[model samples]
Target: MVAEEAEVLVVGAGLAGLRCAGVVAAAGRDVRVWEAGDEVGGRIRTDVVDGFRCDRGFQVLNPAYPELARSVDIANLRLQHFGAGVGVRREDDAVILAHPLRRPTRVPGMLAKRAVRPSDVVALVRWAYPALRPSALTANTGGDTTLLAALDDAGLRGELRRVVDRFLAGVLLDDGGSTSNAFALLLVRMFALGVPALPAAGMQALPRQLAGRLGDRVSTTRRVVEVSRDSAGWRVTAEDGAVARARHVVVATDTRAAAALAGTDPVPTHGVVTDWWASDREWPGPPMLFVDGRSGSRGPVVNTAVISAAAPTYAPAGRHLVQASALWGPGRPEPAETQMRAHAAEILGVDAGGWQPVIRHVVRDALPAQPPPLRTRRPNRAGAGLWVCGDHRDTASIQGALVSGRRTGAAVLRALG
Candidate 1:
């Protein structure tokens, strides 16, 4: 086959790749993207099964993300926002701890449930105050510590602790609270500022929207296996033997793939297994993510949500869609279908006996682990001709991926000039 020539070639069609290509193309540079997967969006994919839309992994798009708002057309996504709160499942009942300001009417009911203590509430405010300021993370002035330590230091040990810890674990996919305190606080700040939502179509819509802007520049089913320096610039070869020669190359794949192609060390990643179910009955509770708050209840599921309640388009007209997410760890395996169903039922306070299994997605590298002393930006320029960018290169989030991509694209442009 004749070798394809590209002025700039980007490997992987995830958010980073699409964003980088967009930047380069916007600058009037010839850029092309090759995605190994059958579709764009990388891990942010959705599968249609029996008329239900099941995202590869449970994910939400936060409009508060600066890069997201700047890059994508948020209105087009048709976002269905979740309630600004979390449902904590206790031994006997489930209580929703909503934002006092956003859901003022619910606050009286929440306080009546005694779901949170005044002291715990005070501690939470103190711990989250610094995170609310974007300057804190930008300047990296405050000393960092583990999330657990920070919470302890703030004296947040109460029912609120259990609820918040599990809720965050589901979001970060880190059950042990080993994530950076600063990072966790930043996430909390986002939650405070914006309500995350699912697109009317699904989470994959975000990347699809990005890829659509590139027109024919994005190519899927092109699993890149090699990237080596050549006289002109670099050569990218796919497993199918197709070759692309470019003046600049960007490794914009996942952490392991990017590290392998860029000759850099791979960062640790956290995995998650999400089970999707379709039930004829709907959950009566408000559309919010639920976490186990019952003391010492060590079930496989970290969080469960009535996805259809939040986004009706995800399910058929009469059916409801539910998602149960569990962390994938060392020696930990996917739970049996029955166990997941039972736990989800318990969490939702509904009968899941008849709920039909739709799909179970096991993503081994769902997220690059973010540890303490948070470093938002990692080295992106790997060599003279090769560069790297991903969520791993910046913060581990949609925001990070877009920022890294734009930064890498600018670097490539500068190199070519």
Candidate 2:
């Protein structure tokens, strides 16, 4: 078969690959992208199950992502925002700790329940205030430590501390608090600045919009089996014997695949299992995330939410969508169906046994591990004409993926010139 030719070739049509293609294409370069999956959106995919839109895993699109404005139309996605608060399940009842600015009405209740103590508030501010600065995420100038140590050092061993820990477990997929404190604080800053939301269509809408920008440049189901350097730059061989030759190649696949194709060390990863359920009963709770905050209680389910309450489009008329997530990886056995339901029931203060199970997504590589000594910019160039980009190369978030893709694209352009 005749080999395809392009000035730049991007493997994997995830947010990173698609964004890189956009950058190169915008620069008048002939760029092409190949995706191994049957459709775009890589890890950020959604499936319709009995009229419910079940995303591969629990995820949210934060409008505060700085790169989002430069890449996709957030307004066009018609985002349905979650309430600026989190419901914490205690031993007796569920309480909420809300954003002070956005949910001022909830503040009085939070204070009444002692969910936000003065000491805890001061400690949290001391720990996370630096990340609110513009240069905190862009430059790694601060001292680094595990999240636990940072919180403890800042004297945040209160009820609010437990709430932050449980909430971050669902977001970072790291229940151990071993992730970099800086990275975690940066995420908190983003959450404070912008409300996390779901598009009316689904989380996949984000990547779908990016893929649509590239038109036919993205070819799905063309899994590249190998990437090798050639006299002309590099060659990518797909599983079905199709070949693509390019002057520059970017391995923008997931962490494991990128490591294999680019011959780089595979970074550690964390996984999460998310189960979606459909219920006939209306959601009785607010449209926000619910976390297990029973003091020192490490339940099987980290977090869960009445997803349809926040975004009605996720469910069909008269039905509701709910999702529960648990940390899944080494030493962390997947929770049993009974345990997941029980924990979710406790968190939401609702009977979950009658909810119909829609689907369970075991995203084993949900996110690349973000360890301490946060290095926002890892080397993207693997060799002369070889490069790599993904959340693995930067922070483990949508913002990281898009920024890494754009950064790699510019590097390739400079090299080509």
Candidate 3:
């Protein structure tokens, strides 16, 4: 049949695509977003089952996310901050890293109680350098360079591998090997900007708000089959034989999808598994915990969060919710659910026997595994009238996705002008 026409055709209704559509439409341009799933948010999805609200994966927002805080109205959304310092659980020891906001008197006690070795604390302080300086941290090459190389020297490597890497792996879900040293610096920048924030309702609320703001410009359940250029502009064919033509098009899906639509082959993307537990305990609140699970018996379990305490609406009153995640190496066998429960129980200091986790989510292609001096990132513009945007294009995170979308949108706008 005939193809629909618009000034801009955005594929993927995730945060990036929706954001692009919103910005373009707000600028008085005709923009339409095509979403493959029946829902709007891509990976950032939430489900309500049996009076419980659960996100596909536990996600948090750093107040420092430039795109979200600056472009989107986050204040209107329900948000809660994790207290300053993150809590850590290693074997029998449980400790809380106090945020700088704590009273000076309490800071020492908290650190001491948490059993934070003086050297570990010192290493943490040193690592905070790049984060404190916005200009230095955001430098284009800052994220691409290796942290090890930047701090190449004696003692530092030992400290990083022993203390810093362990802690970071617990938080970021991947060892520093899969990410850039700049990525760590960015987290520090986020902490320096403001505490990590979570939506009171659920993670999906953020994307839903963005989609709602876009009005009738979004089309859900429209899977994009192909993206190619024609003499007039760009032609985007959906799975159902429907076509959309636009002067500009943005592919904002995940990396695999983006590659497929652009007629490129798929590359290896490291996978990770996340488990969410909801029960009767009180969630300890945000600054959620990040344990250095590298030393644990079960293998590398990084980046665990106590989400319910971070936000009130995640669970029913008096009930707590916790999300524990771990990244598996390529070709590694998936861990059994029983094993995950045991690990969670040991980490959280609770008897997980009766506390059933309602949700289990596994992202086989969570994010790309980029080594230091990260490579494999594609450009935003694939052709004259077509563009690409997603977390995979740069750093891997919600903020990265938003920034990529904004950048692609700006580029498309400029090209049109």
Candidate 4:
């Protein structure tokens, strides 16, 4: 095998790449990362406007993100927790799903409301049991079933579907049919850990902090044009004709980008558009809401949240920030902004006509459509010295991305040793 120069080279500067770079660099290996964009953080993007901090889309840190918490010093960041009760808006009436932290005994009362049917409550109880049981819930077993399939009764299925769709709009980013039951259960488990929290500065703070830690080891705007293997290692050609040979190469971009770079037959992946808004009014409460089972004039709008509403730092004093996201299925037609605004106003009670959202951004490929078995995923190790890491390769979420990156880094370190 032709020997390569550097110990490791990581592609993409998203969460996965950052984690991989941090690990390999800390291990004293010669690690370098190439990012296509001018900045890192990949999909975990945040923007600040008019004193309001808005994320590319609404993002919540699962207090249960084990690898993320361990890898980074998140406690030092300005983080705030969600309110004890999460509101569910359906047919314009708000139903509260109170967390255990707020009112321990009132959970039963909240569950008994008309918004959540008795059957739905029973299904929740059954589902919660396995999660509560030790050894049943773990990383590997998280995405095993679809949320709809887990419930035995039709009534329970319908109720929970509405509750989840309307309240936790962005939770799955998939239609009811496509969402995994196990993943939904895992989200419920996150609720037990702590309501979703946000960093004081913004979501981008997390990635910026990670990049800062890596220092000069990371490079930006260096698009990797092609990746080919040599006898000993791999050869990575940049768009500018610059070449880098490495003992190991980690592809940590999204599945689509990774497939493109690796020359694999691209698979069909769904795309989404996320719009962020900054408002002057203080959000009535925390921004975590579920918008399920509501009939909209423009068909079904999946999930919506007020990110800045969840914490004071997200927006300037007396102002709040909101992110409304719509997941378009593969081949699904894109809805107009007017349609989205109308739906958001109707479901979220935000006066779309009156409120002028200060900052707006859209993501074409928000996340891959997560189907059961996640067959389109590529293994972390692709070839002799080429490795892959991304949320799509494992569970499709922030935690999954971190885990994949850490595992790939470990594997490369071992192979080099």
Best by TM-score: 1
User: What is candidate 4's lDDT per residue for 92-113, written digit by digit as tens?
Assistant: 5766666543355776686666
What is the per-residue lDDT of model 2 for residues 128-175, given as tens digits with 9 covering 90 to 100? 777767475546536778998988899987678888888998999997
Single out the weakest 10-residue window by summed lDDT for candidate 4: 134-143
- For lDDT, candidate 1 versus 4, the one ahead is 1
Error of 2 at 395 (Å): 0.9
Put down candidate 1 lDDT per residue, 162-267, tens digits, no spaces: 9889999998999888999888888877887899899999989999999998999999999999999877779999999999999999999998998789898899
TM-scores of all predicted structures: 0.97, 0.97, 0.88, 0.88
What local lDDT score does residue 27 receive in model 1, on the 0 to 100 scale?
A: 91
lDDT measured at residue 37 in model 4 versus the true structure, 0 to 100: 86
Tens digits of per-residue lDDT, candidate 3, 125-165, equal 56566566656554565346665554442234432344456
Look at candidate 2 and tell me the lDDT of residue 113.
68
lDDT of each: 0.89, 0.89, 0.70, 0.70
* Model 2 spans with C-alpha error above 4 angstroms: 101-109, 134-142
Better of 1 and 3 by TM-score: 1
